[model samples]
Target: MSDLIDDPREGANEPEFTVSEISTAVKRTIEGTFDHVRIRGEVGRVVHARSGHLYFDIKDDRSVLGCTAWKGQVARLSVMPEEGMEIIATGRLTTFPNQSKYQMNVQDVAVAGEGALMAMLEKRKKKLAAEGLFDPARKQQIPFLPEVIGVITSPTGAVIRDILHRLRDRFPRKVLIWPVAVQGERCAPEVTRAIDGFNAFTAGGALPRPDLIIVARGGGSIEDLWGFNEESVARAAAASGIPLISAVGHETDTTLIDFASDLRAPTPTAAAELAVPVRAELLARLEEIESRRISAMRTALNYRGEKLRDLSRALPRVDALTAGAQQRLDLAAARLPGALTARVDRGRAALSEASGALRPSLLARTINSARERSEDRGKRLAPALERSSAAAQGDLARITKRFDTLSLAPQIDRRNDALAQLMRRFKQATEVAHSQRARKLDALDRLRLTLGYKATLERGFAVVRSAKGEVLTSTKLAKAHAVLDIEFADGTLSIGAKKTARPSASVSKKGTQGSLF
Candidate 1:
């Protein structure tokens, strides 16, 4: 007013400002004060623009500030902005002086220390470990023939495909899929849920319980694979009664689930390998055992044949000893003294009668009569004596021959008897061999029961199955796990169930229950 010029309707002349003038003055003031500065902060709200500009917010727990990088400046950045990463951003401060708005035009960026993220990971790992999630005792052994294998992974990812391919190639067993999110914010919860679902199914008896469960994912950054290391997922794996095989990330990377699970496989293929025995190897082993059995039986038979040969060779020696004794008996019979005495007695009797009739005529008569009688007796006795001697000689010879024959016969009889005895002994030996064979067979049967997969099936202990025909080994596969098939001695049953506490009797096998056929 002091220097005012008179205007129409008593108005005073005043200085007017243009938009460009105000804007330029504010912009110059902001450029002068801040020039260039660098601030360290956690990156947040980072956005990449379609036109190559980058917009972001830098934050601490208590505060947030906006940041931007133009296309030209963005090209110069050496590192990408990641959420929760502490970084140092070099930029000049600029102001929208009209509205008094302020932001940093980021020029360069570098990583700051990652103390907070490390602290969080360490805390979680400790918490989970303290809760026994990594205890070795919590692990379960994987089934040899996993009728149904459960897999938890990103459904559409390469991890799932890899697992499927490996499983098919190795085992070709049935798989029960519990599709889960394997990465991102929701991954931890989904993995935990899948583990829980598997547990419930194993415990309850609806879906056949997976004999083994596989939790697998492809390789990724620590943050991307963090879900497997989550306390929730680890605890769920620990709690699952069914065996779990963890396959997460690369071979070098280990997660919390690896400690919590029954086994840790470097890749999905390794998981499948751990879950099943190699079929070819098993078949080879069976063939080897059969060959060994056949070899053993052949060896047994050969040994028995050798023993029989030894027995056969000993038979003739016993017969020879018997023949010599019989020869001595025959010789004593041929030289008898009794026949000599009988001939001498007749001559002595005739001499005594001649002496008793000593008168000459009487003597002559006696002598004549004695002589005639003697002649008559001699004539009769001559033929008789000759016949007797001949008979005695013949009898002696016959007796000698018979004695020799008898001795030999006895020897032969003894040999024959020994042979019979040997036969009996052989029979006994064969019986012993048979008894040993029976014992071996029984032992083999017991071993078969212990080692054979079907032994348990025969023992009235049937594997429960799901409606989909997968064997249920545990309760983790069902919401309310139900027994589908009841395998019996004769056949299988499609059985419905009720809650009964009484246990069923185990299957008794006819072959093993003291029955030899």
Candidate 2:
């Protein structure tokens, strides 16, 4: 229902129109005054009419208004609209007759303040480039096999959903979410806080450091998307130890954060695609590479095979050269056995001839020599016996003559002379025999001393014999309770052996000597 304004000066003089008339007139006045009216708002309850018309609400913090756009106008949008899309609509105001409502007939619809966003983004890009943040030198490479990935984005937003979906599909890895407001006045600080928090968390060893960071959000109006353009956000991204990939807006949209980041991607999903390689496409490429590698290997193998075949063909010549050597060997091999047999036969024949020729003559000569030696010995023995008999007879005759003469001349004087001569001869014979017997006795005494065991002990030494009759020189040979016979010059004495004392304890100095003997 519409209410009419009251006039204070002429309350009764004014004529009252119907609510519809007032609303229609008002709508007409507004449409006529403004050639184009543009209003910015967030899209809500958006509905596409079947009649090629789109109906939605333009809303802000204070108010909401109805809006409609023809399909022709909607076609110009680079993106599809869902709830909470910020947009600017330029159209004339109109009123619905049946519903009695004011609504906008949008001639043109576009994202609001994108020019400002672009201009700011370009300026920031230049600024960051000057600061070397946007320079390629500052960009870090994302690890192909990262253990963990850090995501700086809205806790509950479509961007996260897209990212998780892509990451799960491409490659599943640990993802740590540092939730932050992505679109608001509080978004910059939250984003900066998240970057710092992630860095701190990694530094404290509570979490593994991120190999890559994804700073992303869904598409929005320039104002809603302004958080990514903040200097703090850019610096945070630039200073993040990890490599950063910025994904903020639709494919056609670009932001200052994108420039500052190591890599820029148009959309959250595209960013995910960039972060990880597609498994199917990568496998296909690997297979292609493997195929090419195998082809190269086969080509190399074939070349080597051809070279081997050429070498194999030349082997016959080598074999022919070797054949001459084989022939010489064969000739040697054939002649060796016959030559050996002939040499053996010759040796045997020579040995047989020598044996045959030497045996009879050697026997005959040996027999003749034996006979001649026997006859010569017989002749010598006969002559020696005859000369020995003659010498015996002459000695007997001389003895007889001396005896006879002595008998005849002997009287008292003769007897006395003979007796003196005999005495002198007897004395000389006794002296000579006594001398020879003394020498013999001395030789026999030396022999007896050498053979006697008592001879060793007679020289101021003791012969210590063990019970087993072995000579015990060392005390180690006689244990405790062992009976040993100590043979000295006078007698043999038996004593029981005792354990030998240790060297250190048994030893004494000159002045500190004790009697133990």
Candidate 3:
């Protein structure tokens, strides 16, 4: 009885415990008290860990509470945590024994209200806008008529059915459906992949590539349609090689993809309408154009025919034009003989008058006197002619002897020998020049063989080039997960470079060694 009384006060006072023991007790109590609780606060200091876990702080105007979502729970989260976003996090509160603090292990997270969702959306819009995804220059022009239209949406949803029905009503088109989750964690990645896949197809292949893509989904709350606002989906839309039409929701519903797309449709049906023109309207336009062309051609032909008829009426007859000329020729021919006879008679009369003016007796006397004078002059010139001939002969003989004394044959021979010597020297110089040029050409050929890129390829060395055809001599210019082309002597090989988890230490070491070498 004495021991029980002594120990009652002592046992109560001696109930002290170690730090770990007290922490364990507190952890259990807090975890049990806050099990399956929902907390509403604005998110702050969000951190996505490399392990796929999320760490964040949830705070009101009064105080803050640390929160954590494991990788598995994060996958199920409807809204990813962002700073200053009001959200409702559902989980259990637990204590960290090591740090002596308590936090919530979040099982799921969602936007608290419409206001919070809009605020988050606006924030994302600003971020994407800064990256130039919403630039007008980035937008493509929608094709007037697409041969194949790629549709990205849930196949079972009303959005696809509406789009197809509208297309059938207006103009039937070939549609390739890429069914994807429209409102979940899978939505963003599936849509992004669909856009990229459509672009990757080779044009004019067996499965013809789509000329236009329509990403459609029905109207929903901001949270339900949040996938369209994902950065990946927006960027994929912006970078699409094929023109894209964004029909994410109703006219009032807008998403980030709309800004990046080539055209934004108010509804799925409207997107189809924008894709192609009505067949009946097109046929009517073609018929009108054909009628106008036929009318113009007929008018032109009629004008030409009328002009030809007028020209024929204005033309003169060929026989009538030549009759006057023929008459003039006949008159000239008839008077030609008479005119010639008159001219001959006039010439004979003039000649007879001139003959009658002279006398034959006077002419005979003058001739007799002229003959006697000619005989006297001949006798006087004979002796002088003989003397002049003798002197000329002597001068000719002396000139002949002088020519024989100074002969040109030997001088001609000497000149020919000098010319031959010069010809031989010229030949030697030409041969020397030809040999020098040949040696220089041989040296140039050797230099080309040693310095040319083809020679390097022949030595089993390859040139690495990027997709843009720029030569890549170092890793700095090479992009991770990018394709590269290697040029060899035989052919070219295409390959992809994977990003290394850690940079190699040997890179720097080799660079130093290369510098030394």
Candidate 4:
């Protein structure tokens, strides 16, 4: 109906255009004029679009400004705008023609001031704490004496110097300095990388991996030390494989990394002190302990010697102890000769009394009586044997006649057929058992191949072995062997080291090996 009605004043002296044309012109004009600008405002409603775009309103008491950050730009934002948070947005301003609105296309974002930064820091701290990053259970105990200490800090700063000096004064140890920016924009990422780089090292490699890591920075304002407050830096500290000691800023100045680290130091100098004890003091204490041990040992020996002397004094003399046994032995010796003589006389008298019973005539009579009895028994046994043989022969002759009379061919044939049938069944059962065992053997072979490490060698991996055919699991162990066998997918490689001296199993040394086996 509105399209049908025509205006009477269609042609006028003033210039005119369509709504789209005017909007396009306005869009171009506004974008050209305010191509780049920074706007500081308090964040209002924020919308994280499903398409990875961030839409939000920045408003003050009077007016509101619309801001948007696309997916590509959102990741680069130092501070992601949150509700009720103040932020300074840096981007180009452009108007939307269709919607008849103007919006700021945010390229970067940051907290407006220290207050906002503190607010963000507090919020992040709460979030990370809720995730248990700061839990005491996750904190690792510091090594009593770390052989290698990795220091992460700026190379040009006196903080690292102070740490090294303090470490030198206390203890001498290997220090791996990972130079990184300790302040400003590059600080967080560089520090994080330093931590990860230290952790990536393999033990006993060409470069010795650190037993402990120290992240350090000098004292400064919150803004100067903001890098340690970054979430990435804190998470890196928490996730460090090596135990990390955070020594950033002064004692009173706490950062997020301090909470996530295994230990916190008041200053960079203090971190070194925590790493190890003073060498001179340790030596002195050891000497004192050794002195105490020697003194105690001497005291024990003296006490034992006194007790032994007292016991010896209380003991009877050797001659006194043997006197009673010697007297008794002498008494027995005096009676032994007379007793032996009496025994001999009694034996002679007994022999004389029994001499008459062993005469020649008496022996001859006894032999004749035994011979007569033996001859009678032999005659009776021969007759019994003859009668039993005759009876056996008669029975055998009778059974032979009965066997000849019966037909035995059919029973013999039946027995043969049954035997053949049993043989056939046994053969079939043997075949079935053999087949089952063969299948099981094949399955076992496949399982062995699957479980073996050779198949995995094709995937850019190799199995390292010592010359003694042992699988070397660690670099230190591999280095211990002069010859290494590296098995790849295609073949095996045997390589020799510069110095190939295989250690002997015999622990025997001249006066050094212990007496106990």
The model with the greatest TM-score is 4
**TM-scores for all predictions:** 0.41, 0.43, 0.59, 0.64
- Candidate 1 root-mean-square deviation in Å: 36.7
Q: Give the TM-score (vs. native) of candidate 2.
A: 0.43
Candidate 4 per-residue C-alpha lDDT over 1-517 given as tens digits, one digit per residue, 9 for 90 to 100: 9899867685666888899989989988989999999999999999999999999999999999999999988766766688988988899999877688999999988788989888888998999999999999999999999999999999999998998998999998999999999887678889999999999999989999999999999999998898899988999999998999999999999999999999999999899899989999999999999999999999999999999999999999999999999999999999999999999999999998898777899888888888988999999999999999999999999999998998998998999999899899999999999999999999999898888876688677888888888998876677677888878899988887554444444754552322100
Model 2, 225-304: lDDT tens per residue? Answer: 77777787889888887778888898776667887788888898988888887777879999999999999999999999
Give the Cα-based TM-score of candidate 1 against the true structure.
Answer: 0.41
Worst 10 residues of 2 by lDDT: 508-517
lDDT of 3: 0.90
Q: What's the residue-level lDDT of 181 in candidate 4?
A: 90
- Give lDDT: candidate 1, residue 135: 74
Against the reference, the lDDT scores of all candidates come to: 0.78, 0.79, 0.90, 0.90
lDDT of 4: 0.90
Cα shift from native, residue 64, model 4 (Å): 1.3
lDDT of 3 by residue, 279-346 (tens): 89999999999999999999999999999999988999898899999999999999999989999999
